[model samples]
Target: MTNKLISLLDYENKAKQLLPKDTWQFISGGALDETTVLRNRLAINQRLLQPKRFQHAGFVDVSTKVLGSIIQLPVMISPAGSQSLAHDQAEEATASASSRVSTVMVVGTAASRKLETVRKVSNGLLWFQLYHHGTALTEMLIRRAEIAGYQALCVTVDVPYTITAEKDLRNHWKLPYGTEMANFTCDEAGLGIKSNTADARQYRRPPHVPVTWDTLEWIRSLTTLPIVIKGIMRADDAVGCVERGVQGVIVSNHGGRQLDGQASTIEVLPEIVRAVGQKCEVFVDGGFRRGIDVLKAVALGAKAVLIARPVFHGLAVAGDVGVEHVLTILRNELYEAMALCGVNTLAEVDRDLIYNCPSTAPL
Candidate 1:
C-alpha cells in the first residue's frame, strides 16, 4: 500500500481513508471558517515558476544548512502534538525517519512520547518545539530538552490561547483514551493527569501566560541553545525577534490552526525576509506540500520550509517508511524543479525565478 503512494497528496488521500472520520477532520480542519487554510493553498498555487532554457548544469543540489546543521534537503518536519493519534510509535517513528533522510525534526511540547524516549531512537538533529505552559513547566521542559541532546529550541509564540477548531467542536473531538502527553505526565512537573483529556469535549490547554519580550529574555537566560521563534506573521514582529537576539524566525500561521483569515505564510515570507535581511535566518511552514512550493519559498529568501500536515499524513499511511517516502518524493521533485529552473543549488534561487500571476498580486 505504501509503495503506491507517490506524492504527499497520495499519502493524504490514503490517510483520510484509513483514519476515522472525526480524526480525519481533526487533522484536516482549521480554525473558524478556515478561510486562512484555503488561502494558504490558493496563494501558493497561484504563483508561477519561470523555468530557464538550456541552463542545466547536469546536477542539482537541494542540501542546505539551518543553524549549522546540514540537511539533505530544506524541508524539515514541523512539531505537532499527540502524533499517537496517527500511529502508536508516534514521534519516535517520525524521528527515525528524519534521521534516515538526514534532516531535522522538531519534537513538540505535547508529544505523546517523552523527549528522552524519542531521542534514544534517532542520531539525527532534533530541535525541541516549546509552547510556554508557564514559567516552571516551561523551564523544566527546556532543561529536559537540553539534557536530552536536542540541538536547538523553537518557541511557538502565536497560540496565546487555545482555539478549538469549529470542526473539532462540532464533532466533539478528543484524544483517544490512554493517549499520554508523556512530558506532562510527571507529578514532579505538577501535572498529575495520566492523559491530557479531562472530558470528552475538552483537552488540556497550555496556560495563557502573557509572553512578553521579557519572557523571551527569561527563556534565553535558561538555556544556551539557539532560539528560533515560530509563528511570526508581521515584519515588525520579526524585527522584534531579531532585536531580542532570536537566531531564527519561522513565518507561520500555525498551519492556519491558530487564527482564521490571516495571510498565508508564503504571502508574508518576502517582507519578513526583507525586514530581517541577513540579521537572522527566516523560515516558513504553512501550505507547503510540494518541491515547487519549497523552491518558491527559497527563491523568496526563506532559509528553509517546515511541513506539518503532510508529515502527519505520511505517518498515518505507513509510519516511518511513509514519512521517508514523502520526503524522498519532495527531494526528487525539488531536484527536477531546480534542474528545470536552470539552477544547481539553493543559493542560486532568487526572486526572479518566481512570476507572481496578476490574480495573486497583493492589493
Candidate 2:
C-alpha cells in the first residue's frame, strides 16, 4: 500500500521476502567466495561522478545506438536462463514486459518457450541468446530465431563448464515440472536428463566442443544475424572479438554467476573500451543496479548496459508488471542522474563525469 512498489530498492526488499530462500540465494549468490559479486557493487560505488558547469543546461536525452539500432535507453536485459522459476509467463511474460518499457530483452536458448514464441510476445527489439549444444542444433535455433523476427544472435561464451551452486545443493533445487531444454533433447552422451536432482542443483558436463574465436567463422557460415559475443571481461578478448568481425561484444562476468574472483565488469570497462571500443559496439553487464551505475559504465565507454537477477526479482513479485516497474526505476534514475550531471545525451557523458574514488574504490 505504501510507495514501496515505486522504486528498485523497495522492489528488492519485497522480492527477497516473496521468493523461496534457495531460489533467492541461487539468483543473487555468486560463485566460490563471491568476491566478484560483492566487488561489483563496490566497483560502481568507487567511481567518482564529475559534474560539469552551467553549459547548454537544458534538453537531456536517454536514447542511444546499440549495434546499429537506436534503443530508447542504454539499458538492456542480459540473457539469463531459468525464468520459468520466477513466473508462469517466464520468457514470454518477460519479453512482453520489455516491450512495455521499450527496452531490449535477450532471450536465452534454455528458455521454457522457444525463440519463435518469445518473439511473438515481445514488442521491442529482440536478440536470441545462444549456448550451442552442437552445430546442427545451434544452426537450427539460430535459423529459427532469425525467422521469428530476432534482430541479432547473442552467443554466451562464458559457461562451457557448468558449476553446481552449493546453495542449490543444500536446497535440492531442481527445474520444476513441464520445463525441458528447448534446444536439444539430450547432451552428447545421449543422456536425456540435464540435472541429477529434482532441482537440477547439479549437472554433468556434456561433451560439447570448447567455444573459441574461430567459432566465429563457423557461426558466420550459419546465419546472417549480427553476432554479439557475451561474457567477455579481458581487454584482449574484447579486441579479439572485434577483429573476428563480431557485430557486438558484451563485457560481462556472467552476472557473478560463473567465476567469483574475477574483476567486476565496471573495473575492466575502461581498458576493454580502450582495446576495442572503436572496432565495434561494446556493452557491459554486472552490478548495474542504479542509473548512476549505468552512467558510470557509459562514462567509462560502454555503449550500453545489460541487467540480470533484478528482472527475475521483478517477475517473481508481480510478473510482467513487476519487470516493467524494475526497468522503469532504473531508466528513471538514469535520466535524473543525467540531468544533475549536466549531460544532455550519452555521447555528452564522457570520462569527465567519473574518476575512481580513493576509498572503497578498487586499488
For 1-363, candidate 2 gives per-residue lDDT tens digits of: 224687766777788888888878878887877888888888888787987768546888888987777888899999887787788888888899888878789998877666777888877899999886777667777877877889999988888777766777777976555566543433432335453344233222234455786676798777888989998888898787777778888988887788878988888888888888888888999878999999989998988999988888888888888888888888889899999888989889888887546664442
**Candidate 1 colliding pairs, count:** 0
> How does candidate 1 fare on TM-score?
0.95
lDDT of candidate 1 over 104-203, digit per residue (tens): 9999988888888899999999999998878988998998898889999999999888888988998998777756567877543455555545531132
User: Clashes per prediction?
Assistant: 0, 5
Q: What is the C-alpha lDDT of each candidate?
A: 0.87, 0.80
Badly placed stretches (over 4 Å) of model 1 are: 187-204
Candidate 2: clashing pairs of residues: 50-353, 173-199, 174-198, 174-199, 174-200
